[model samples]
Target: MAEVLLVVGVVVAMFVAYNIGGSTTGPAFGPAVGAKAISKPVAAGLMGLFFFVGAWTIGRNVVTKLGTELVVDPGVFTLESSIAVLFFIGIALLVGNIFGVPASTSMTAVGAIAGLGLAGNVLDLAVMGEIVIWWVVSPIVGFWVSLIIGRYFYARFNRMVAMERSTGPLLDVDRSGPIPIPRVHETTNRRELVGTITVVAIGCLMAFSSGTSNIANAVAPLVGSGELAMDPAIILGGIAVTIGAFTIARRTLDTMGSDITELPLTAAIVVASVSSALVVFLSMLGIPASFVIIATMSIVGLGWGRATRPVTVPEAVRKEKAPPVTIDALAADEPGEELPPIGEEDPDKIPQASDLFNPATTARVVLMQNVVPAIATLGAYLTFRFVPIFGI
Candidate 1:
């Protein structure tokens, strides 16, 4: 019975990992694909490769943290309970996918395990508190960094990162020898080549960050139970993520391509780089970082900063300041109605970019993202505290 449950737990963990890969690939490679630096297949391939590398190198710390530190005893992660936890995670991902809501898999995984730990009377408050602290801190950091860049440096960065495509292939491959070598195309200039590489490198960086944070979400429960070793679990989860990148990620790439909310190339790079670095840092400390929240906050910060920036361009005219355009400039000549104050213009009439970022809607979206994890936590608590399952 234990062996059968172990198998079941690993399978469920794989399912959860697969969904994570599909969901994350769009954000990781969206810029690369958007810029035509790489196709969906190549993006997915690089995603799997870098993801595996990250998991092998740095993801083990997270496994130990989730399996041991988050609870008083790793022994509480019995095979059946691991399966149950994975089932909750899988269900959360499925619901998120169906509804097109970007739930945090890391949050859901931690919630389920924390629920089990609490029910078992073995929850480690200090460790959980630490994880929670990082979660809150990382996003704020990403937001501020992105905000500064957007407000002060976005235009220059955009101009620098702008990629223009040439007519020929980026690189020509010669496979006549035993080894295949790629050389730059005759038509591909240095700027275009560098820009192309930068875009794809950022995609791989995002993937590496995702792997660092997310591999734990997939197999931590099973590893905690001692039914699976860390290396094997990482490898298995990597395989599942690869499967997702190849299969379901194709649809995600297409959707991202067509989405109106897709970030511009420079903005995407900034957001991805900031958020991914934060996630990788937290993962190194064995914390399950919330990549979704970090990315969202970074995006919001960038947009807000850009929208609020003052016009700094001085025209080619005299070295004097330009007159401000006020609402009085639009006063009706025929009517005697008094013009409203300069700052009192109707908000609807102003085409402000900030209007698109409705705070209420963003709050609702964030809250909704947590619903699945909340449900999982409650369900795990009730089942373990009340039910007579698994002989805990």
Candidate 2:
């Protein structure tokens, strides 16, 4: 019976990991695939490799936190309870999908575990508080950082990083020699090549960050239960994520890539870099960061910063004037286009506000994102506390 229960626990954990892979691949590689810089297979391969690298290294810190430190008593993570927690997480994912909102797997997993801890009267308030604080603070930090960049450096960065791909294949493989050689196509300029590489590299970085933070979400319950060793559990989770990257990840690739297309390439890169860096930092400290919240905040910050460019910070604070809100912040400025200083740029040149970053829309997204995690926490707690079946 114990062996069978363990098997059931492992299977549920794999399901969670599989969903994680499918959900994360698009955010990591969407830009590269969208730009035609790499094929889906190549993106999946890179996602798998970097994800493993991250999971094998800094990801352990997070695994330990979830599996051992979050609760006062690690023994509360019995095999039956662990399976129950995983079920709540899986339900969160399903709910998020049905609503067309990608849930934060980290938050949902943490919520489930916290729920279990509370039900058993083993909840570690200190650890849970710290995690919650970081969850709130990290996204705000991402927003401000991105806002600063959007306000001051966006034009210059856009000029420097933006590249429109030229017609034809980026590289050609020459198999005439014993060792095949790859060469850039005549149509591919140095700038284009560099831009393509940059996109793919950023994608890899995002994948690494995802693994660093999310691997624990998949296997922590089983590991906490002491039925699965940490190393093998992580390896199992990584395998599940890889399988997901190759399979269901295809749909997400299209969804996220299309969304990226709507945003300027430079803006997407900036948001991704800011959010991924924050997630990696949090993971190093054993915190499961929510990339979705951080990225959304970054996007809003970038847009807000760009829109408020007509007034300097001091002027806005002092009520000198109201700056017009505009979607022009995301507009790709041409290279070497001369622009006035921050406050001196003409407001008339910026277009009026659009639905790109509508407040209602953003509020709706933020509210929806929270719903899944809340449900997971409440559901897990109620089940473990009230149901006699789990023997919690």
Candidate 3:
């Protein structure tokens, strides 16, 4: 019976890891793949490799936190209870996918574990409190950092990172010897090649950050239960995530690249860098940071900051009339074009923020994202506390 239950637990953990890869790959590599900087297969391959590197290193800290420290007793994570926790997380992932929203795997996983801890009377308030505090603080930091960049440095950074892809293949295979060697095509200039490499490198960084923070979301419970050792659990989760990257991630790459939000490549890079850095920092502290929330706030802050650039602080304080708030500020200046002094740009070019994003739609997305995790918490709690099946 124990062996069978352990098998069930492993399978559920894999399911959770698979969804993590599918959802996270887009955010990590979408911009690079979308920009034609890298092929989807290459992006997926890089994602898997870097993800493993992260999970094997810094990710262990997060697994330890969630699997042991978050609860008063690790024994609460019985194989049966662990499966229930994973089930709730899997449901959250399914809901996010169906709604065309990428949910926070970290938040959902934490919620489920918290629920189990609460039901078993093993909840550690101090640890949960610290995690919650970071959750609130990290996104705000991402927003502000992105906002400052968008307002002051974005134009310059954009100009530097911008690339116009020239015709011809980026690389060619030379079959001159027994082993073929790949070389940059002659037509690909230095600037374009460098830009391409930068984009792909940023994608790898995002993938590494994702692995650091998200691996625990898949296997923490099993590890906590002592059914699987930490190294084996991490390896299993990494493999499942890699499978997901190669499979379902193709659709996400399309969605992130073109559909959900049309972030300029520069803006995508900015957001990815800021959010990935914050997530890595949090993961180092054994915190499961919410990449979705951080990235969303970063996008909003970048747009808002750019939009507000038409009004200088002094002018606004003096009650000088300013242009309406708008995200169109992002497009007001072309990459590499000289930006006018702050508050000097024509107001006529910027559209209202409402034009870029509908409040109703935005509210719905934010609400639904929170609601899914709440459901996971509530459902897990109910199953453990009220139901006798899990023996909680």
- Give the best candidate by lDDT: 2
**Clashes by residue pair, model 1:** none
Error of 2 at 291 (Å): 0.4
* Global Cα lDDT for candidate 3: 0.86
- Candidate 2 per-residue lDDT, tens place, 291-367, comes to 98999899988877777778888998998977654455567367789878978987776776463476876786788
Against the unseen true structure, what C-alpha lDDT does each candidate score?
Answer: 0.78, 0.88, 0.86
Q: In terms of TM-score, how similar is model 2 to the real structure?
A: 0.96
Instruction: Write down the RMSD of candidate 2 (Cα, Å).
Output: 1.4
For model 3, give the 10-residue run with minimal summed lDDT.
Answer: 322-331
**Which regions of candidate 1 are displaced past 4 Å?**
175-178, 311-361
**Which segments of model 2 are wrong by more than 4 Å?**
324-326
Candidate with the larger lDDT of 2 and 3: 2
Q: Over 4 Å off in model 3, which ranges?
A: 177-179, 317-327, 349-354
lDDT of 1 by residue, 105-224 (tens): 888889999899989989999999998888778889988887777656665566666667899889999899999999998999876887788878888999998899899999999989
- Give the Å error, residue 90, model 1: 0.6
Ranking by lDDT: 2, 3, 1
Highest-scoring model, TM-score: 2
Candidates 1 and 3, the one with greater TM-score: 3
